[model samples]
Every structure is written in structure tokens, then in C-alpha cells.
Target: MNDTNIKWDKIFYGRAWIANIIDIIQTKDILQSFYFKRYLLRAMMAGFIISIITVFVLMVKTTFSLDWGPGLVNMIGAITFSFALVLILFTNSELLTSNFMYFTVGLYYKLIKPYRVLNIFMLCFIGNIIGACVLFGLMRLSDVLTPDMVTMLDQTIETKIHTYTFQNILVRAIFANFFINITLVIAMQIDDVVAKMFVMMFGVTIFAFMGYEHVVYNSCLFVAGLFYEVDHLALWPALKNIVASFIGNYIGGGLIIGLFYAYLNDHGQFKTHRNK
Candidate 1:
């Protein structure tokens, strides 16, 4: 680890994480050239990569379901899902869920314009959708999924989009991203790779096992379900789920965590005993 990592490892306890989060938010605001088109392209590429990886992991989860018990099965799925975010973070890629925190923090700090942040979000969202559609199409054409796997995916589709009411979907999504982004922020505050991975896995596993909705991951899964002609997985219903998840994720990550933390940290309300 470097000096910054060493310093953080020594002092990253309690509310000290707030200082670290603020420093990271400020660093992203200062270093990222968000106004440039190249940066937009980079964001798109990052979202694209994340979508592809997400689909692969979901496929693994659905395909191997018969071999493991329900709890272990979900655990395996969550672990693989957590790996996708880990790769995104370590590679410096943009994920919309995580970016929600960044954009919110930047806006609160007056370091980024609202319009610019929205543009970043739109670009990344579109990119992720496009990537997901491509992967689904490819998987369908290649006959990659077995009939049993397709059935399993269809059941998941029913569970995610069809069974839940709009309100139910929105609420679950809120809690899902709430825990996810919290994990993200905590992991970002830490320096050790092992600790970071462990925390991320635990947080992601909690949400995944709870069957919470996430916009990007669901985009791919629903599209793949649609492509496979899964029952009740229509375009309109899937779209509704996606939109509700997006809103809930924004609330959970952007407002709940980002705005809340920024407010407390800015007003010097984060000085717990550990910091002193």
C-alpha cells in the first residue's frame, strides 16, 4: 500500500470514513473531465463492460441452480454478482449505481452542474442498456441457455417484474441500492484489497439474497428473459421495473447516502470519538 493507503488504514475508523468519502468525491470531481465527449465515451464503455460481466454471472447463477441448495445457490450468485462491481471499481469504470453517489456529492459540493451530471447518467444508462441488449441477443442466437435455464430465468422474470406491484418494486429497489451503495462507499473508504472485497461481497450478498432490484443488472436479465420468450416478461412491464428501479436507486444511493453524508460531513457533524 502507498502512503495514502497507509494513512487511511491507520485512521479509517468511525466517522473518519466521512472525510475519506469527501476526499474521494472531491478527487473525482477534480480529476474527471466530465465536460469532454471523450469522458462520456469512457463512461459508456465502462457501462458496457459492466453489463456484459453482469449477464455472464447471472447466467452462471441460473445454470448452476440445480447443484446447490437455495441458500448456497443465492450465495454463489451474490458472490459472482459482487465480482462485477469489484472489477468495475478496480478498473476505474463507471457504474450508474456507484456514480449516483459521485454525482450527488459533486452537486452538493457545487463542483458539478446538475445538467452535466444528468448527461453523464443518461449516457451511462443508455450504454448499459445497449450492451445488455447485445449480450442477450447474442446469447439467444447462440442457444447458450438450456431449456431448464430458460425456465429458471423466466421464473426470475416473473418474480422481479410481474409479481410485484409498482410500489412493491420501488420500495425493494430503494433498500437494495441503499445497502449496495453503502457497501460501495465503505469499500471505497478502505485501502486493503481483501477488506474491500470482503465488505463488498457481504453488502452485495445481503441485497441479492433479499431479492432486491437493481436497474443495470435487471436490464440485462429482463432483456434476456424477453429474448427467450419467458412468460409475462413483456417489454412494457420490464420497462416499468427498470424505471422504478432507477428512481429508487437514485433515492437510495444519491439522496440517502450521498446527500445525507455530504450534509453531515460539510457541517462538521461527523466528528465522532474515533476521529478525535
Candidate 2:
């Protein structure tokens, strides 16, 4: 084959991408045990690790005095935050936002039952929150932050708590996970580690820099804020944000990307492929 054809074979697009998603759903079915309970702990662990990284990133950004102009700070921060998803993907964790796509694909193909998928999603969601809360408690106890870092953390929390409305959170959540699901779905079609990393970073950057909502990441930050005694971040508002964002993420990942891709590929026909 010519060099162009050879290059093309190294990539997955079109029918191959769709077929890979089908394969992914099948693999998810086989891994039901992990999904049901084990993945929850794994996801929690992943959240803890990611939250630490997030703290570092926020702290570092605070240390920098460079006047990089509008959007530059967030750009740097977003790229740093992108590592969270990379860690999740590499570690085989069950983050809720990402799983929206996976569970949807499984359900669409009838490879897994609805109740089972819900069980896994709910477990993963709660697990992520618990993991983040643990980290928050530890961080508070350790007194690990410098005064500036604490200020930064407080400011971060303040913004999240004070700046957003219910509508703002919902809209941003939709697009945020739209980009995220693109990353997860497209990454599924590839086999190369480097390629996967690049895809994930790009997807995460888009989501973060755009100021979109991601439920797990938000949970980490929000809970961490609670440790700081951010008054605006009352339990009720935080819970509301989580619920709205969760629904938005489900729509973006599960409906917009996952179901759309399945429908496009095979009109989302169940009868023919249900047995597979």
C-alpha cells in the first residue's frame, strides 16, 4: 500500500470507529463485575489523585505573576487539569461523566440491562464524591497549603459557589461533556497510547478552557471548598449543581454523542445486534 493508505490504516474513523464502539460495549458487558462495585473504588481513587493534581495546578497558577492576558491563565490551568482524565483513562477508572457514554453504548446495544447500568452509574457517582470528600478532609487536616494557596483555593471556591446560576451550570455541563464524550468515544477507536493521550488532552482542554461543567471534577473542587467554610457553597446549592450537571452530562455524552453515533452507524437497530 501507498504511504497515504498506510497512514490511514493507522487511524480509526467512519465505519471502523463505529465498529470499535460496538466492540467497547461488548467489552463493558464482560466487565460487569468491575463496573458494579470495583470500578467505583477505582474511580474514587482516581478522583483523589486528580484532585491533588488540581490543587497543585491552582497553587502553581497563583504563584505565577505573569500577565498573560485574558484566557491565558485558564488555558494553562485547563491543560494541567487535562491530566485528570488521562489518569482516569490509563488507570481504567469509572468516572461518571465518561461512563455516561459507556453505559449508554451498552444499553443501546442491549449488551447490559438498564437497571444494571443505573446501579453502576449511581455507584460510580457516589464513589467519586466520597473519594473527593476524603481528600478534602485530609487536605484540611494536613494544613498543607501555604497562605497563598489557601487564598487561591478559597477564591476558586468562591467563584464556583457565587458566580453560577442553575441555568448557567446546566448549559455549560452539556457542552463540557459533549467534548469529553468525543474524547472517550474517539479514543476507543485507537490502539496507540500516544494517540489516546493526545485525544484526551485536547478534549479536556476544550472542556476546561471553555468553562464547562464536569460533575466529578466539580465535586472534587466543591467538596474541597466546603472544608474551607465557603458560606455560599451550602450543601443544598452544591447538591443542586451536581444534580443539574449530572443530567446535562448524561444528555451530552449518552444522548448527543453515544446514541447519535450508534444511530448514525446502524439506525441504532437493536434486534439484529442485540444478541451480540
TM-score of model number 2 = 0.85
What TM-score would every model get versus the actual structure?
A: 0.80, 0.85
RMSD of each: 6.5, 4.9
lDDT per residue for candidate 2 within 89-122, as digits (tens), equals 7877668887788678667777778987887787
What digit string (tens of lDDT, one per residue) describes model 1 on residues 175-252? 888988889878867789999988987888788778888888888777677677777688778889989999999998
CA error at residue 18 for candidate 1, angstroms: 7.1
**lDDT (0-100) at residue 263 of candidate 1?**
68
Error of model 2, residue 161, in angstroms? 3.2
Best by TM-score: 2
For model 1, name the residue pairs that clash. none
Predicted model with the maximum lDDT: 2
